[model samples]
Structure formats: structure tokens, C-alpha cells
Target: MARSISDTGSVVRAVRVWPVAGQPAGLPDSLPEPIAAVAVPPAGPSWPEHRTRFAVEVVGDGASGWHAPVSEAVARLVVDTLADGVVGHDAAAPRKLAYRPRASRHHQGAHARQAVSAVELACWDLASRVSGRTVPELLGGTVRAHVPVYASALGLDPAHPEAVKVAAWISEQGFWGQKWPLTKELLRQGPVAVARVLGNLREAAGEGRFMVDGLRRCRLDEALGLLPVLADLRVAFAEELLEPGGVAWARVRAAGAGVPMAAGEHAVDEHEQTRLLTGGAVDVWQTDPGWSGGLARSLHTVEVAADLGMPTFPHGDRLWAALALAGACCRDKVPAVEWHLTLEPLRQRVFTDPGAVEAGMLPSGPGIGLAPTPVITSPLPVWTVGS
Candidate 1:
């Protein structure tokens, strides 16, 4: 007789969150100042100097699953409220395990939501390991063997003399495209300056292969003014141009802006994502699994986007999850994933495999492939909860 799904599934036995000290290998001693810092003050400590990092692990009867590079606060939030519900539950059913915490608190906020998402991701990783399958395969067999990725130039300053050189290097590296931030400071420099910088970047990155992130710092008029320049440059897309929850304004902008509009990285739940999709807010969806309630919710958003004739280009924070979704979905629906050029090298240092890109594509690896490296030397977990 063949075993059923339940027979093979593992129950969650314990959950642990560890705080690792010191920076991982491959991170530069100093990083370029972020473009957003010019317009908006940073909310927390700088990444280079921030010595502590968190990783979550879910231990089960069959195997252990892991997800790293979350905040200490988010890891603590998991142990405090969400871990009790997760303990002793079926690890294979991550969505079901996530429901109690999501439904119980009306105001779990982004940190709490991220905690739930981390646990949910761990559960899926555990389930995939127990079943001897990759997370993408477990989700539904992969549609593509490799996922294309674009270089997201987060820390690279467009005003720097080497900006064009960096853009050309990224192009030479075979990235699908390069995205540069459009901070309000840059916008205030007037459209002439904006056009010149973007024009030079486009020429360096290759025509039709450059994208812009407005960083949600621009006013309606500023964003509208940018549309013509973006369209004339034949930019790939403009992301988060207006303030959050300005879907109506985004829709209006999309109607007239020849460049495609993208958002939803800040949408915390399915309801918010649904509103964005239904309101015709954007031509492209850019949900992040790590921050947007995990892979299950992100996948659902991808499906909804597909049904509505929109494409999803998942945010790059959690590269493994983004790669999993891109691998599982039709190429047309999820054509590419974002690669944070500056941050990913540091992020990848925690993983054993690093999931390196070749020819601008990441090969589908096994089980979300987030096994932590020896660099995570913390002997004691900050928090642990078990059945």
C-alpha cells in the first residue's frame, strides 16, 4: 500500500531562533551610502556596522528546516506569540499553521506578520526536506529550470562618477537589466538632470534594459513629471513612484505613463494585495515573500496577478523564495526576479550554496537551499519553543 501525505508529513517538534555575531564573509568593510538616505532618514542601524543577525530553524521528527537573515525583533516575535500555534502541527500545511496568528490579532503589524512568515517558511522547508523534494517542486513542479534576475542597484550612487562603469559592468555580467533608485533628492534636481542621468544609465545598461525605483518619495506632480522621461527613455518599468495606498493615483499614472508601474512590496496581506490588483494600480506586481506573509501568500498573489493579465517580479530580499516562485510559475507570468546587487552578496554568505547566478539566471536548487554556513557561530539560541 502507498503512504498518504499525512503519513509522510512531519510534525513541528521545536522552533529556534539564533542571533549570529560579526559580519559574514564577502561583505565590504564599507558600503556606499544608500540613495534613499538623501531623501528619507534610515529607521535603524546601518547594515555594515550592525553586527547581529538572526536565523530561524524548525526541527521536526523527520528533518530540520532553516531560514536566515531576519531581524532579532522578528525572531523574538515568533517565539513570543506564533510558535505555540506552530508546535505539534503538520509541517506540510504551512498555510494552515499560519492562520491562527494571522486571524487572532487584528493588528499584528509588519513585524508580527514577518514573524509568522518566517515560521511558515521554515515549515515549508521542513516539509520539503521530509518529502525529499525541492520547495518549488513541492509547491507544484517547476516550470523553468532557471530564473532570470535583474541587478537592483540599491547602494550604488547614480551621481558617482563610476555609476556608468558599474552599470556597464552589470550589463557585462549578463544581468537581465539594472534598476536605479529615483530618490526625491534626485528628482528635485529637475527633470533635465534626471533625464541626463537616466539617459546615460540607459545607454550604459543598454536601451530598454534599465528600470527605476521612485522609492515612494515623490509627490503626485513629481511622479507625473517623471512619466514622460521614463517613457521617452523606453525604461522597462517604474516602481513605487507614489506614496503607499495611493492606488487610485497609481492607476491614473499607469493610464497615461507609457512605462509600466509596479508596487505591492509593502502590502502586508492578501486583502491589501487584492485591492492593488483589483484597483488596476499597476502593470507589474512586486511582492516580497519574506515581508509579504511568506511563499504561500506570495504564490497566491502571483496566481491572482496572472489571472488579471499582470506579471509578478518578486522583490529580492528573500532570494530563495523569489527564485522558488519564479521557477514554479510560467516564465511569462514571472519573467524575472530582482537581485540586490549590493546586499545579496552579504545575504548569500549565510547560505551554504549561495545560489550563485550564471548568465543572469539562478539554477533551481534543492529545498529552498537555505542551509546556514559555519559563519553562524552562535551556540545558544535567543529563543526556542517546542511541543
Candidate 2:
């Protein structure tokens, strides 16, 4: 069955993009900057010192306003191309509208696709609000209310013992799964050391499943060499073993290694996403709605992978990014979303209770379900396009 959004009779009136910073309004108020810096693992993406995030707000002539955070590259496009492109366009079929940019842009890099992604999501969010429904409802409803999550983080320096603590904390925090980088360990101690660390992590994680993020630092031979250990510890997937679109994908897929390989955190548009998923290059698809050209295309990628029975685990570095996908992910199909325990406090700074993980499920609320703190909203600017 082909999917196309039918125009529902609403027109986009305006779009606004801005940078924001704030403290979490949810329970357990915002942490002090110094404390937050200490709280998050050193290698995580978002840091307290650099808590600022880009946001895209969309308004409709008939529908209420909606907004979501944009990362990588959305500001320029919002003020230039996308703002003009979306105004006066039909608002009902967001994914269809998203196709133009996906095809038109030649060298669409991180920022370009991020703006497009933000626009697509703004349309869907506004439409969902207009229809008095949730984003997931528009996407055909979800399989469950609460989404299962995996604790995702990075290990400290090679000599540091924080990997054990990070793994232990993730396990005790109730996440059903865990993913941590082997950057320093692998560089300092080599594959054998990483294998031992993983074994220790498996012990620390107890019943939780384990996943490894190579951060594009693991070589083909290194990752291949670790397969036996991966199997021994029952590791689920090895992410970003080498640069995306490299021969490594086919090699691993053909190696009969039995270890599922994952990538796509850097996919900028549909074409790259297609190349990654269409040929069975990777077994597990790891995309970021914020970076993969937006929520619309990200979901499309998820659908494509789902058809092939490949699980979709959208990156969880950005809390808002995860919130946007909650309604679309199914427990049986998608399985888990990534969450960084150390960054939760900083994540809360942008929105109250960004998305709560309880008993291993992420239950979403209505209409973006997040409110910006005053630090990020004061003197807010809203851009409008005329009829």
C-alpha cells in the first residue's frame, strides 16, 4: 500500500527558527552548569556549557502553532529557502511536501537536511494539533504508549574506570538495553581489551542487552576480530564500524559474522538513506530525526527498514528528537530508543520532563508535549509569510 498525504485544507502561514538555552522545568529542577557538566559523561554530544539548541516553529493560517528543536543546519534554510518554500503550500501532506527539498538539493549536507527535517516535522506537529490528535495518531497510531529505551553514553579515558560505573548505572537505572562507545579502550588496550570491557559490561548490565558504538573508530579487521567475543557476550549490534557507504558494510553483511551491523547517524538525505538501506548494507538502521533531513524522512527510512524486518533505532542524543519519534515507534517492531542518563538533567533544561523512561517504556504526551523555559523563550520572534 502506497502512502501519500491527502491535503486536509490547511495552509502554512509562517515559520520561525531560533537558538535557545534554559533550565529544565520538570521535577528535579535544572541543575547548575557546573553540576550538569559533571553529571553528563564527558564524551556525550550535548554539554551543559553548550546547552543552546536550534528550534523551528511553524504556524498555519487555520491551525495552531507547533515547534521542535533542529540540529546541524536549519537556521539558514529557515530564514531563506524553506520559509519561502513552505508558506502558502498545503499543510496536510508533510511527507509529500518534504520530497521537493529531498530531491532538489544537490549537495545537501548536515545543516540543509536538518532544516528540511525541521520543516517537515513542524508541518506534522501543527497538523496533529489542528486535528486534535497526536503525531503518532497521524502516522497510524503506535503499538504501545511507553517506548522501551537503552541507556546510551561514552566511556572515559583509557586509564579511567568510569566504563564500569556508566554500565552499572545504566543497568540499575532500569533501561532494558545499553550502548556505550569503546573509543579510548580500543585505542589504548586494543580489541582484546575491548572484548574484556564488554564482558565486564555484560556482567554490569545483568539482564539488559548490550550494543557497541564504534563511533566510526573500529576498523574492519578489529570489528571482525571481535565477532566471537560479541557472540560470547550476546552483543546485539556493532554500530558505525567504518565510514558509512564504505565497503565495510557489504563485507560484514557477507562475512556471515552473525553480528548485526548498524549505521546511518550521518545520513543527510533520502538518497544516502536509500543507498544505506536498499541493499541490505546494514542489519540495524540507526538514524537521527534531527540530522537525517528531519522527522518526515527519518520515519520514511524507518518504514523502509521495517519492511525488510530491520529494526529502527533512531539516535537518542537529542531528547526532543526522541520525543518526536515516540508515537511512530512500535515496541515489537522498533524495540528500543536511546537515552543518555548522564545528560537527562541537561536535557531537562530545554523542556520539562523531555520524555520520561519508566519501566523501560517512553509514553508520549500530546502536541510536542514540551514547553520551553524562559531562558530560551524570552522575546521570542515569530516570522510570518503573507497570503
Candidate 3:
């Protein structure tokens, strides 16, 4: 008889949260500094210059698992409140151990969700290590050997004169596709200019090889105007073209424009996801496990979306979880995952090789495969709570 997860007797023993200092890493000189679609004043010192990210680790009887880079506040929340529920529970049953508000009275907001997500991921890692299985294996054995990924050019300005060259280079790098933000600045250049830039990029990257992100920076009218141009360029999809929850209107307009729409990275809970699905707002769903709850909830969302004939390309904010889902789920359901070009390297600084992408695919590894290295020189956890 096979041993079950409950048979392992690996209950959670400790949870630690800490800040990790960012370090400078080499990036391609040809690539320009990435910029935000909506420029806002800096809240504090920038990355690699200060301690900007946090990490979480869960310890079981004889195994440990870790995840990184959430906000310090989230880390503190876990240490102060959430860790208590996690400490004596079955580490292998992450869904049951994950934090949830006591009742409807307690507000369930982004911070709570993030806190839950971090703790839950650490639990999954701990569970995987205790069971001597990878997260995908624990979820259910992988359906594919590797998960395909797309290069997300979050900071690369699409309006640059060399944008065409950059697109060609990305395609040559073996990414399944590339996604660039359709910024307000680019849209201000007028429809003709937008068409020219997208046309050049499409020609450079080849047909069906690129996507665009509106980043919810566009007015509904502005997004509507771009639909025809996107369709004409044969762009793969237009992601978050308008503000979230404008579902019904977006669905009608998108259907009329003959362009596929995508959204849901900000839909962090079931209410939001249900609205998108019931409204038939998008052709593609892009849930982020880190924000939507954890691997378990996000995977459930993927299944529901697939049943409705919607495919998911999970947002890359939490690369490991997204990769795990993509690897384990049906290929037709989870076609690929986003790989943010500017953010991933910085995020992976604390890990050995957990989220490395090669030739547009993520290679399989044990557990969540994220363990902090000496590179994380933080002397001690900012906070810790144990059973």
C-alpha cells in the first residue's frame, strides 16, 4: 500500500519571515532600463540599493521549504498573526493550513491575501520536501515534461527606434512569444503611430509571436480604439486593456473588434474571478498564484476557466507557482506562463536555480525549488513564530 500525505507525520514546527537585500546583477547592455507604464514618485529607496523584498521559510520535523520576495508588511503579518494557525497543523495539507479570515466581518483584503499566499507557498514547499516529491507531483503528477514561457518586456519601451531590433532579438532567444506594455505614452502618439510601431514589431517578431499589455492604463474608449490595430497586427492577445470589472462592456466590444482579450492578474479572489467568467469578458485568463491565494486556489481557478473554454497563462509575479501549474495541468488548458524580463532576475537572486527559464520552457525540479542562499546576507529574520 502507498503511504498518503497524512501518513508522513510531518507537522509544521516553525515559520520565519525576513527581509532580503537586493543586489546588482548584470543585464544586457543593449536593453534599455525598464520603465513603469504609470510613472509615480518613488515610495522609498529602489531595488539593489536597499532591502526591498521579504522571504518566508517553513520548517517541518526534518525538512524545510522557502519562498521569497513579498513585502515587509506581509512578512510581518505572517509572523505576528498568520503563523499561529500554521504552526501545529499538517504541513502537507497547505490548503487547510493557509490563513483565512475568521468570518465575513473581518475584511479580506490584498494584504491578507498576500500574507496567506506567502505562508501557503512555504507550507507547500515544506510538504514537498517532507514527501520527497516536487510541488507539481504533489498537486498531481505533471502532464507535460516542461512548461512553455513568454518573455514579458515590462520595462522595454515599445516606442524606441530600436524596438523592432529588440523584438527580433527576443524571438531569436527562443521565447514562445514576447509581451510589451501598450503605455499611455505610446497611445498618445495617435493610432497611426501605434499601428506603425506594432506593425514593425509584428513584422520583426513574425506572425502570432507577440502580445500587448494595456496595464489598465487605458480608458475604455482608448482600449476600444486599439482593438482594430491589434487585430490587424495579428497580435496574440491584448492583456488588461481596460480597468478590471468592466467585463460585460469589454466582452461585447472585444467580440465586435475581433481581437482576443485577457485579464485577471488583479482579480485576487473568487468574486472577481467569477465576475470575469460569468460576464464572458476575456478569452484568456491570467491569474497570479501569489495574489489570488496560493497554488491550490489558483489551480482551481485554472480548471474552472478551462471548463469554460478559457485558457490560462498565469501572471509571472510568482514564477514558481505559475510554472508548477503550467507543468502539471493540461497543455491545452495552460498553454504558457509569463516570464517578466526585468523583475525575474532580481527576484531569483535569493534562489539557487528555482525559476530559471531555458529555451522558453521551465525545467522540472523538486518542491517549489526555492531555497535561500548566502546571497541573502540578512543576519536574522525580521520576525519568527514557532510552535
Question: Candidate 1 clashing pairs?
Answer: none
Models 1 onward score TM values of: 0.89, 0.82, 0.88
Specify the highest-TM-score model's number: 1
Which number leads on lDDT? 1
Ranked candidates, highest TM-score first: 1, 3, 2
Candidate 1 structure quality by residue, lDDT tens digits, 1-387: 996645765677888887755444443434433322221223223654245678888888757778777777777777777777777778777656755543245445687668777887777788878877788887788788788889888656786666877777778878888899886668899778899987888888764388899888777777777778999888778888876567546554655857888888988776788898887777888898888888888999999899998989999878888888788898888989998766676667666666567888886554443333324667787788884
lDDT of 3 by residue, 67-137 (tens): 77777767767777677767777876666664433322332678777877887777777777777777788
Tens digits of per-residue lDDT for model 2 on 41-138? Answer: 44334444244455666666555444444442355566567777676665566656754433244437776776666676667767766676666766
RMSD to the native, candidate 3? 3.9
Backbone clashes in model 3? 1
The parts of candidate 2 lying over 4 Å away from their true place are 1-10, 22-52, 62-64, 71-73, 99-107, 155-162, 318-326, 366-375, 380-387
Worst 10 residues of 2 by lDDT: 366-375
* lDDT values, one for every candidate: 0.75, 0.63, 0.72
